[model samples]
Target: MLLKYIISHTRLNESSVKNTIKLLNEDCTVPFISRYRKEATGNLDEVQIGDIVKYKEQFEILEKRKIAILKALEEQNVLTQELKQKIESCIDLITLEDLYLPYKKKRKTKAETARKNGLEPLAKIIMSQKANDIESIAYKYINKEIKNVDDALEGARHIISEWINERTDIRNSLRNQLERHAQISTKVVKTKAKDEKAQKFRDYFDWSESLQRIPSHRLLAILRAEKEGFIRVKINIDDVRALERIDNRIIRSNNTCADQIELAISDAYKRLLFPSLSNEALSKAKEKADEAAITVFAKNLKQLLLGSPIGEKRVLAIDPGFKTGCKLVCLNAQGGLEHNETIYPHPPKNDSFAAIKKIASLAEAYKIEAIAIGNGTASRETEALVKKIQFKNNIQVFVVSEAGASIYSASKIARDEFPNYDVTVRGSVSIGRRLQDPLAELVKIDAKSIGVGQYQHDVDQNKLQKELDVVVENCVNAVGVNINTASIPLLSSVSGIGPKLAENIFNYRNKYGVFKSRKDIKKVPRLGDKAFEQGAAFLRIKDAKNPLDDSSVHPESYKVVEEMAKDEGVTLGELIGNEKILQKINLKKYETQTIGLLTLQDIIKELKKPGLDIRESAKVFSFNQNIKSITDLHTGQLLPGIVNNITAFGCFVDIGIKESGLIHVSNLSDEFVKDVNEHVHLHEQIIVKVLEVDVSRKRIQLKLHKK
Candidate 1:
C-alpha cells in the first residue's frame, strides 16, 4: 500500500521505488545506497533516493495522523464504517484533516454554549429548510437560558454557523477560491518604516503581489519584514465571491429559514471559515518559500564544499589585518600546523621591511610552496606585499575567503583541535588548511555560517540544516576520505558513521596505529558490521596491500574484482588503471543476483581511477591588482572576478574589492535566466563588465562578459 502511494506521487518505476523504500527502512544512508547498492535501487542517484526518503517519511506521518483520528472518532462513539474507510483511504493531509474536523475537540465556543442551552434541535430543524414559520418554531425552544424567541434563534444561528464551518464541501470551495485568487498585501507600520534597520525592507512597505506568482526570496523578505514589526501582511481575496460560493453549497430555498441560514453563512464566512482558510493559504505559501530558499542554500553549500582543493601543498597562510597586523601560520603538506607568528606590515606598526624579511625567511625555513592570504581587511595590501618579495622557490599565491574563519576559530571544535593556541593562530590555520583541502577543513564549521545563503535566518532553520547536512554527506562520500588521515569531523560526515563513531575511529586509530586497510575499520569498538558496510567504501587507505582498499570498490565486491583480475590474467595492481584491459572485460560475466551490470560497470569505472578526487585541482586566480575598492571601479571596465556566492535572484562576484558586485538575473544574459547556477558557480573565475557603482550604498552592479 505504501509502495503504491510512493510510486504514484514520485512517478518512478514501481520496482525501483519499492526497492529504495526497503533499503531506506533497512537504515541505508543515501550515499551508501547511491554508491554501493546501485543494483538494488535501479541506479537511482542521491537526489532520487532522497526524494523517496522524504515521501516515505511523509507517508508515515500521514498514517500516524489517521490512526490518531480514528481513535478519537471511536472514543466519541461516531466511528461509522464509512467514515473509517474514508479516513483510512485518504492520501493527502488537507483532506484527511477535513474528514477529522467535525470530530475535533474545541474550547468553549458559541456553538457549545448554544448546545448547552438546548438549541441544537432547533438549529437542525431550521437547517432542514422545510419549515416556513421559523420564528414560531424558535418560540418553543425559549427558556431561562434563551430568554426569548429572538434570543433562541440567535443561539440556533450560532450552532448553524458552527455546522457550516465544519462542512467539507463548503470549506473546500472557499479554499479553492483563496488558492487561485488570493493576493498578499502589506502595509508599513508608520513609526518603524523610517527606522534605520528597516531600510533594507523598505521596498516591501506598501507592496501587493499575487500569492501564486511571488518569488520565494521576495516572499521571505516580506515575511521577515512582518516578523520584525515593520509591516502588516494580509492574505486578501474577494469576500463576496467566496461567501456566494459557500451560500450556494449550503442554502436550498428563499424563506425566513433561508434568511436565517444566510446570516449563519455570513457569520461563518467572516468569523470562522475565511480566517482559518486564508491563514492556511498563507502558511502553505510560506512553506513553499522556505523549501525554495533551503534548496538554494543547499545547492550553494554543495558547490562551496566541493570547491577545488590545492592537494596537500605546504602553505604559508595569512589572516590580514591593518592595525592588528597579519597572523601567519605555516602548515605542512598534510595540514599539520608547523609554526605560527604575527607580522605587522600595515598601519600602526609600519614594519613593512621587517615583515617582508620575516615572511621570506619563514617561506624558506618551512619550505612553503604556496601562500594563502585571507580576503579580509588589508588583503589587497598584503597581497601586494607578498608579490613584491622574492622567494627561493616559485610559490603560488591565492586569496582565500575568510567567510567563517572567525566562527571556526572560536568554536569548541577549534579549541579541541588547538588547545594551546589562541583564536588568531587557529584562524590562520583554518585559512591555510582551506586552500589545502576545502572539503576537509569546512566540515568542522557550521554550514550556515559559511555565508552562502539568501535570507538564511528567515527560513525554517531546522529544514535548512537537514538539507545542508545531506549535501555535505553526499559531497564528502563522493570525494572519498582517506581513513588514515581524515579528522573526526570529516569522518563523522561519512555515511552511517556519526560523531560518536567518528570519535571511536579516531581513538582506535591513535591507539592501534593508522588503519592499514578497509578491514581495520571493523576492529573499532561499536563500529559494527552495519557501519562498516555503509562507510568502508568511502574510506580510502593509501598504499594498502590490497590495492582495491584505496579505491571506491566495496569490500563485499573485492571478491568479484579479484575474480575479474584473475580472468584478465593480471595482478590487482596491473589490473587497476589498465583502461584497455578494463574496457575489454565483459561485465555481464561477473553479474550475479545481488550484483547487476550496473554495479559491474561502476566497479570497472572505479578501477580506472582508484579513489580519484572528482573535484578539480585548485588553481592560482588573481583579482585585477589595480581595483582595490568600490571607488576604483568604473562603468564598462572589464575586471577578473570570482563567483563567491549564488542566490535565486542573482550571483555575487568578488572583483578584487571590499564590496562584492551583483550580477542580477536580468543582467546575467540577454535571454531569461531560469537558474543562476547555470551561468556561474562558487569560486568560478570569470571576467565581468562593470555596469555601475554606488559608492554611498557600497553596491557594485556587474554583467557577465560575453567573450
Candidate 2:
C-alpha cells in the first residue's frame, strides 16, 4: 500500500519504485544504486532515486505518528472501531491531527470550567437548536457557581465556542481560506529607524505582499529583518469573510439558539481559529521559501564545484594585499608547497623592482607555468605587476576568486597541512590549487562559506547542508577521484567512504606510500567488501597493473573486458582506448543475469577514453585593463566579466572590480530567459554592456552583450 501511494505521488513506475526501495533498504547509497543497479531501478537517475528515498522516509515517519496516536486513543478509552478505521486509513498528517484534536488532552479551558458547572446538557440543547427558551434552560443549570440566567448562558456559549473550534470541517475550511487570501505585511520599529545596522533592510521596512506571491529571496529578507528585530511581520486574511464562511457551516436557523451559536462562532474565530490557521499558513509559506532557497544554493554549489580546472601545473599564487604585502607561494604540479615569500609592490613599502626581480627568479627556478592571483584587495595592481614581468617561459595569469580562502586558511585542515605557515601563505596555496582542480580544493571549505549562495544562512541549515552534500557527492563521483592524492574531505564524499574511512585511507597512504592499484584500498582499516563495492568504481588509480582500475570501470567487470580482449585476439592494454576494437564487440554477448546492458554500455564508453577528466580545462581570461573600480565604469561601455554569483532574480558579474555588477533577469538576453543558468554559468567569462552605476549604493547594473 505504501509503495502504491509513493508511486502515485511521484508518478514513477511501480516496479521501479519497488526495486529502488528494496535496494535502499539493503543500505545501498544513491550513487551506487543510480550507477551500478540501473537495471534493477529501470535506469532511474540520482534525483529520482533521491525522491524515492525522501518519500519513503516521510511515509515511515507518518506511520509511526499514526501508531502513537492510535495507542494514545486506546489508553484514553476513546478508540471506537470507526475511529480506529479512520485513523488507519488516513494518509496525510493534517487531516489525522484534525481528527485527533478533540480527543487531545488540554489545560482547564473556559469550556472545561463550564462543564464542571454542570452546564453540559444546556450547551448540547443550544447546539441542537431545539431550545426555544435558552434562558429557562440555562436557569435550570444555575447553582452557586452559575449565579443568574445571563451567567449561565455565557458559560454555555463558552462551551459552544470550544465545540466550534474543535470541528474538523470548520477548521479545514478556515485553513483553506487563510492559505488562499493571506497577505504578509512588515512595519519598521520606530526606535530602530536611525540605527546603521538596520539600514540594510530599508526596502523591506514597509513592505506588504500576498504571501503566496512573494519571491523566496524577498520573503527571506523580510524574515531576516523581523528576526533581527528591525521590523514586525504579520499574516492575515479578511476576518469578516472568514467568519461568514464558518457561520454558514454552523448556523441552521435564526432562533435564540442560533443567535447564541453566532456569538460562539465569532468568539471561536477571534480567539482560536484565526490564530491557529494563520500561523499554519505562515509556517507552510516559510517551508516553501526554505525549499526554494536551498535549491538555489544547491545549484550554485554544484556549478562552482564542477567549474573548469587547469589540470596539473606548477603555479605561482599570490594573496594580494596593500599594507601587508603580497603573500606568494610556489606550488608543484601536484599542488604541494615548494617555497613561500612576500612581495611589497603595492604601497607603504613599494619595492617594485625588488618584487619583480624576485618573481622572475622564482618563475625560472620553480618552472611556474601559470600564475594565479587572488581576486581580493590590490588584485588589479598585482595582476598588472605580474603581467609586466618578462618571463623565461610562457605563463598565463588568472584571477581566481578568494571567497572562502580566508576561512579555509584559519581552519584546522589548513593548520594540519601547513602548521609552519601563516594564514597568508596557506591562503596563497589554496588560490593555486583551486585553479589546478576546483573540486578537490573546494570540498575542503564549507559550501555556505563559498559565498555563491543566496541567503544561505537565513534558510534551514540542516536541509541546506544535506542538499549541498548530495551535490558534492554527485560531482565527486561524476569526475572520478584520484585515490592516491585525494584529501580526506574529497574522499569522504565518495559513495561509501565516510570521514573515518577517508582518514584511514589517507593515513594508510601516508604510512605505506601511494596507492598502487584500486585493490590496495581494501588494505585500509575498516574498508570492507561492501565499502569497496560501493566506492571502488569512483576511485581512480594511475599506472595500476589493471588498466580498467585506472578508469571508472569497476573491478568486478574486469573479466568482461578480458573476454572482450580475448574475442578480439588482442591484449587487455591493446584493447583499451582502441575505439575500432570496442565498436566491433557485441555488448549483448557479455550481459549476465547480474550485469545488464546499461552497465556494459558504460564499460564500453570508459574503455574508449580511459580515466578522462570530463571537466573542461580552464582558459585564460583578461578583464578590461583600464577599468579598475566602479568609479571607472561608464554606461554603454562594453567590458569583459565573469559570472560570479547567480540568484533567482538574476546573475552577478565580476568585472574586475571590488563590487560585482548585477544583470537583472530582463536584461540577461534579448529573448525571454526563464532560467538564469540556461543563459550563463558560474565562472563563465562573457562580454557585458554596463547599463547603470550607483556610486552611493555601490550597485552596478549590466546587460549581456548581443554579440
Candidate 3:
C-alpha cells in the first residue's frame, strides 16, 4: 500500500504512527490512539499525527487520479512505454495533469484543420532552420490549397503550434514557469448579474493578484466579491516569458526559421499553452486553498470536539439577550434538557433583583455545578448580576462562545429533538453542552457554522464539505464513543456508521434498553459483521463486563485474543490482569491476516490502559479572581490566564472572566518569537503580569517574560 510506503519514507518514527495506521485501518479513533498509545507512538502529539492522517487522504486522491489518467491514455491507443513510466513516477495531481495536457482531447480548431491540409511538414521544416530559403521552403508546399505567404505562414504557424502543444515535456516546463510568474486579478463587470438586488458588487469593478501568495481568507473574499456580482475576475502573468521558454528550448536551433519559430511558439502558447496552463494554475490554486481551509476547519473542529467533557453533571446554560430577557436551560449531566426558564437582570426587566433571586434559587435547588453563560448581548451585565446570586458550594461560572449555537438551535435537528422548546432555550442548551464537550456537541452542526476557517463559504462548498466530514469522522472516531448514551448525531459520525445506520441504532436503543456489552450491538437492526468490525474499535462501553469491549480491540479479534491468553497458560480473564505478558507474544505467528500481529499488539496495550475515558485530562487553572476585568487591573500586576487564541503577533488570554487580553510577542518573555505556534497553543493556561491597561480602548498589555 502507498500508505505503508509513505510510513517508511516519512520522519514519523514513533511506534504510535505505526500503531495509529494499523488502528485506523482496524477502526481505532485518533483520540484513542493519541491518548492510549503515548509509548507506542514515541509520544507524537495529536496535531502531528492528525497531519499525517490528512496527508494520507490527499495521497489517496492523487492515486485515484493517477489510475484514471493511466486508463484514459491506454484507451486512446497512444500510451507509450516511456509515457507510462513518467505517469507512474508522478506524485502529485498537478504534475500529472501537466504531463497529460497534450494527450487530452480538444475541440475542432484552426490548428486541427491546418494539420489536415498537410502543411505540418512545411511548418516543421521552417521551424527546423535546415532550409536555405524560407520562401522556397514555403513554396514547395504551395498549391491552390496552400495559397500565398499569409495563408502559408498562418498554416505553418498553426502546424508548429500544435507540434509544440503536443510535446509533453515542453508543456510541463512552461506550466511550471507560468505558475511561478502568474498573477490572478478580478474586476467588477458593473453589468448587473441577472439579479439587480445586489448592486454593491458593481462598484468593485476590477481586482487582481499573484496566484501563489494569496492568503486563504483573501482568496475566499475575492470569490465572494465575484459571487455578489461586484466584479469580473481574471489572472495576469508573464505569458510572453512562458512562450519564450518554449521558443528557446525547441525553436532556438533553426535560425533560418527563427523569426517564424518565435512567432509560431508565441501563437502556440497563446492559442494552446496559455489557455491550458492558466486553467490548470487557477484550478490548482483553488484546490490548495480548499485543502488549507479544510485543514484549518478540521483542526478547529477536532479542538472543539476533543474539548474537555464535564459528564453527567447538572448545568445551567444561558443565552444572553437584551429586551427579550435571558433564556435559560438546565441540563442534567447526560446533556438532556431537564427544565428551562427566562430572566432579564440586565436592563428593562420589571425587577432585576427578583430575576437574580429566582436564578439563585434554581441554582441552589437544581444543585448546578456550572452556569454556562453565553457571551452575547448584555452578557457582562448578566455576569455582574450572576455574581450577586448565592449558590451551593463552588458553582464554577463560565462564559461560553455561542458562535453557531443559535444556528444549531434553529436547525431541523434541534426542531426534531425539541419540538416544543423555543429557539432561545435550545440555544442555551447548546451553549451549556458545548462547554461540557465541544467536540460531541459541535459534531451535530456543520463545520462551516462553527466559524474557525478562512473563506469557507467562498471556496468549493462540495469539496470542503467532504473534507470536513472526513475530519469530523476521524476526530469522532479518534475519541471513542460512549455507547450507553451517545446521541444519534454523534453515533452516526463514527467511522463506519451512516445516517441510516445511525437512525437504526437510535431506534434499537429506544425499543430496547442500554447495551450491557459491546457484542450486544449485534442485536441492533441492520448492524452486520462488517459494520460491527469497523465501528467496534471506536465504541466504548465503560460498564461492559469485559474491559476489552471498552478498548480498540474489535470483537472479531477476541477469539484470537483468547487463543493468545491460552497459549500464555492463563485464562482470558487472567490475561486482562498481569498485562506485562502481552509483550511476550509476537503477533506475526498468529496466522490470521484478518487480525495482524501489529493489531494484536495494539489490543494487548489497550488492555492495560487506565480507564475507558481515552481523552485528554482536564487542566487546572486557578485564575487570580482579583483580575476579573481589565479596568480592575493595575500596572505590573501578575496573573494567570488561559491562552484562548494565537495570531502572528501574539497571544490572547482569558483572565478568568469577560474580555481576554493581548500579550504581544515583544513582551512574551523579552525574547525573540519566530512562530506563534512554537511559543503557545490553544487552551494552554499560563501566567502573565500586566504591563499596561488602556481601559479606554479596552486593551490590556501583559508580559510573559519569565525564566
Maximum-TM-score candidate: 1
Q: Rank by lDDT, highest first.
A: 1, 2, 3
Q: How well does candidate 1 match the true structure in TM-score terms?
A: 0.98
TM-score of model 3 vs. true structure: 0.77
Best by lDDT: 1
List candidate 1 segments past 4 Å from native.
Answer: none
The sequence of per-residue lDDT tens digits that candidate 2 reaches over residues 23-129 is 88888899989988989999999999989987898789889999999999999999999999999888888889988988999898999999999888888999899
lDDT of 1 by residue, 255-280 (tens): 88999999999998888998999999
Candidate 3 yields a Cα-based lDDT of 0.73
- In order, the Cα lDDT scores of the candidates are 0.92, 0.91, 0.73
In candidate 3, position 592 carries an lDDT of: 64
For residues 240-288, write the lDDT of model 3, one tens digit per residue.
Answer: 6666677678764546577787888888777777787778777788778
User: How many clashes show up in model 3?
Assistant: 23
By TM-score, the better pick of 1 and 3 is 1
lDDT accuracy of residue 685 in candidate 2: 92
TM-score versus the correct structure, for each prediction: 0.98, 0.97, 0.77
RMSD values, in order shown: 1.3, 1.6, 6.3
